[model samples]
Target chain A: MTASSALPYQRLHVELDARRYPIHVGPGLLDDPDMLVPYLAGQQVMIVTSETVAPLYLERLKHALSGDGRDVREIVLPDGEHTKTLASVERIWDALLAAGFNRRCTLVALGGGVIGDMAGFAAACYQRGVAFVQVPTTLLSQVDSSVGGKTGVNHPRGKNMLGAFWQPRAVVIDTRTLTTLPARELSAGLAEVIKYGLIQDVDFIAWLEARMSALRALDADALTDAILRSCAIKAEIVAADETEQGQRALLNLGHTFGHAIESHQGYGNWLHGEAVGAGMLMAAALSQRLGWLEPDEVLRVEALIAHAGLPVTAPASMSGDDFLSIMRLDKKNIDARLRLVLLSRLGDACIHDATPSDMLDALLTDFPRR
Target chain B: MTASSALPYQRLHVELDARRYPIHVGPGLLDDPDMLVPYLAGQQVMIVTSETVAPLYLERLKHALSGDGRDVREIVLPDGEHTKTLASVERIWDALLAAGFNRRCTLVALGGGVIGDMAGFAAACYQRGVAFVQVPTTLLSQVDSSVGGKTGVNHPRGKNMLGAFWQPRAVVIDTRTLTTLPARELSAGLAEVIKYGLIQDVDFIAWLEARMSALRALDADALTDAILRSCAIKAEIVAADETEQGQRALLNLGHTFGHAIESHQGYGNWLHGEAVGAGMLMAAALSQRLGWLEPDEVLRVEALIAHAGLPVTAPASMSGDDFLSIMRLDKKNIDARLRLVLLSRLGDACIHDATPSDMLDALLTDFPRR
Candidate 1:
């Protein structure tokens, strides 16, 4: 159960009965078709990827999958949050049916969080739910989006506004795919890595703080260890609460505030990890205001976010009322009442049904207009 | 249990843990707000109806639900098979979001199969999945679509080619709603009513043959009894095999051939139930040709379809090749193999892995060129 002992390898199973699947985390896991082929279910495979990742790793992945009897097809979507729309989802469906993908076929999502979410949503609806595999190529996807069964496309009105919580048959994380990722993207992925620590893993957070430099330097050992730990934590949480009824809300530590920023700033304006970083800072500041955390503890959270090269403050143009309005529409809100997943302390979080007035007041003070 | 004593007034449950819900069938169930309130889960309810049903029953259902102290909203879609599309689905999503419907809201589909499918798909994708209730107003929906939890909009390329199997919290089938149904629409619904009998209910077929006249006349008792019996059978099948692995495919008895005819003649050109009516004859003929069914049995199916005022023959315009190509893309087809559910006898069905060449030959003979 210890991080080191569990490192360098471990398989976490998501027990959804017949739909049960495993998340394999380690170096070079993606190259092994044996890890994925068992779940293929049929001969036809469609690997949904992005323009950016196509040139780098799509060919290798395609080669590996098509090496045997598998008839692999690839559809490259435009890279970015902009492509997560109804139009894009329709295109994926068209390509899938065009390729004669029957209900037995599998859809393989081969990129970051956007690809996984969009592809998974497409799979969930294509012929009323087909099996899908998550070959998450980004650190953020590998650690978070890939582990959770949540998949969806963004609507013009909201991010991830249209989707399903369809768990993938398997998630293949090849840490080597990160070699070509941009520095900013890598840092954004670390934001989620840092979140696991801030929300429920004090020991892991301590370890992350110690290995921050090594991770930034793209040390294979550091990256793999972080991913393994993140997936394990997420797997445990999701297994307990498949849907966000109770404890699963804890995983949305920064997401309520983060979604507001994402929607207000326009999706793709801030990388999800960046918005989450700033959102976590806001949560920490609010926790400090409520006397749940020491002011110094709030500073530590902000410092870690800043050190990871993520935004620690809200965007300048967002007003308190604007943030509150956007957050109120968040799916987490019940009966129009805003619910925030606030940390009681580092490594411990609770869902707070904060009054709108209190939330707005806290947001106003923490992110005051200049 | 005897048919009348078999819980004539009881609720049938589709057990899926937290997602489990009941299907209440009987006279006067629609006015009971208590039956619908528990599933609402929130104060905001959006009732998706059609131009046809809105003028008749929307207000009554709204009033019934209003007793629970919740805000009720209704979106009236154009009344027809043509309205089941991405465009209409987007409108439903837009209306829900515009009216401030968050994840906590419930969508009540208060029309026939088209509205139920489109509205259900909209709910499935709305914030990754929300609760929906089926208030199927047509004979087709009451007996079939409303009970099984299969929901989706149709694509221009195919009927129900785009959808999700998102279960509803409950189904409210008001047999009174069929009182205003046109003679043609009523007969169209009978196509499905006959389907249950063809696949696995010889006794139901005999009952329908004996009572077809009274049911067509919209006799209150006969219609309600038939709807309840069909729904009970569908509920049991769906409960055992939610995803159509084996037994569920039996329910698609005439759908494969019916979908081809509908797609070939153009989506709205043929009433879905009409096409299925004719398609069932072709499947029966093919079953007889394959020595699985007797010629007399095929004649019996054809006679019942004709008695129900449905076409038991293919239209002159469609070609065998066109029908073959369309059936090839059916979701049920595994790999390039065309797997169809064909009747071996009156009360049993088997998944036949028919060769494409043989099926094409059968199509050519059944729908000979002009």
Candidate 2:
């Protein structure tokens, strides 16, 4: 279905000093001919997309970006979470250099998290960084990866081992594209939507409990509100701390546990948001054991993830020790201490590191891959 | 020869507000273990050196950096300009990740410009950027690349196509290392030293002309003075314009022509300073055509380069069009305009874009690589 003209957009400002830019969320924004023009710093533009997103949105994006005497180029790669890497970045570098795009050139990332990360990273280091605009097509990217300006590729040793904090000129998030998302992908996106409510907004949690089904059904109003609130919450946290120094770490409530799930299963076996959804349950369970959360709240967290069609348990192959080992590899670890973001109470998340290992091991026995 | 204990050290401050650091030029600094400890942010210290430098000073540096229960790792790359590439950067990234060096880890560069650029670039992107220290072993890097925050590696299509502007935490330049430098390389470095005079310091030009022989002979006092003055001049320029917006372009007086020379010959074929020396003459000739320079000044520029044992002419294989085409690819070029840093008069330089193409072509036919 084509985007409705009556649909509204929400604009949130990141306000990162000189790097501040607007995150525009709306329906039919992708079809807007001038959506990307203002953020561009030069006439030389390149769209870095994936095999999947290119076929779906490449023509529309190209049409909007071209016909202005602009020198536009495209570098397409196979789609996968595994492809968010330096090798892919090299291919992008080759394309930009072949087209003679200098520091002034602007790279438009027109796909999900992988594309945004790879393209943004290429821009960050190409001639010491070029301006970029993010046109995140996937729901997960719109609410999470594309907004915060944390761009990097994975290394064999760990996820996002090489990266830079490069802010985009603008985030042109077109929620209309969510209509094309697969069911699993759409549900995975809601995990982060649920994350916002879990971390800071009890009222939003109540709102999601009522309206999440509508969002799952692709209801325009519900989906738009979920995305808008998520972006606003994330923007507020990032504006206070752009580099994930303190408050920003709250946004990664489940990501530490999530990263291990992805790493243990290999990068693409379980999608990031799926792992995060399950990982959030683990955090909820941990918080309950610490007496920061009630047993019912933990059950609600797991039930909500399961309702969204996401896994709510770690893989059976992963022991508590295995999870502990991988978690220690996290860049956030200070002097080998495993620092985690756990909910101190439902609707209020906090970073915690004092949980006993024996308690964590005993807790893992309750939830298996099944 | 052993370094004299009585040689007084001089310090030059870069003075960039938040990026400010000191350039310390002295003798026997390698023996001082405390030199780098304060700048290091963590116990994890990695030394990135070259095949040529490893045998000479790596052990001294490693010994100094260790024995304090510090975690030190070494990644030795092959020496030369050819080593400055993404592949080299990957080796570094691999080593850092393998060693589990986080953002707080320090990367110490212990070679010439090539090593300094590669290590600095690695440090810039490893975990979004780690602090680095520069221990330049060559004259060129000591006075030029190591002082500024410019860090990057070369691409096949151009020089330094991928890079970042990551400043080192501190620069430790041990003048004693230069005593081991090849005579040809030492002379090549003088080209940049003379450039400081031609661009901003007239008195420095007169001083160099009077004492060029003493420096060439490796007279400790003369060499010490030239290196100190050159670092101070460069530190001042970088402080005023950290990222080549306006005044910094003057620092590239002959680099536009020189980069084309390096690219055409294949990087590491002709020495960077040798090409810059010759390129400086080309700029002087161009300036004379603009009626901004006298014939005698052009002759002196060429003669000074010749006296320093650097090339005074471009290669015969490259026609004027070749220079123009390659130079247009320079990062400084905007909207296809070929911006060049040309001498307006002796002891002064400015960026010029109005030089007629026909004139440049006519001038190129006069100089050829014999």
Model 1 off-target regions past 4 Å?
Answer: A1-10, A355-363, A366-370, B1-11, B15-17, B67-69, B355-370
lDDT by residue (B78-179, candidate 2, tens digit) is 988877899999999999987888777999999999999999999988988888999999999988999888999988787888998999988988888988
Tell me the TM-score of chain B in each candidate: 0.93, 0.96
TM-score of chain B of 2: 0.96
lDDT of 1 at B66: 90
Using lDDT as the measure, the top candidate is 2
Provide the clash count, candidate 2: 3
Off by over 4 Å in 2: A1-8, B1-8, B367-370
Looking at model 2, give its docking quality level: medium
- Backbone clash pairs for candidate 1 read A163-B128
Error of 2 at A117 (Å): 0.6
- Chain A TM-score for candidate 2 is 0.96
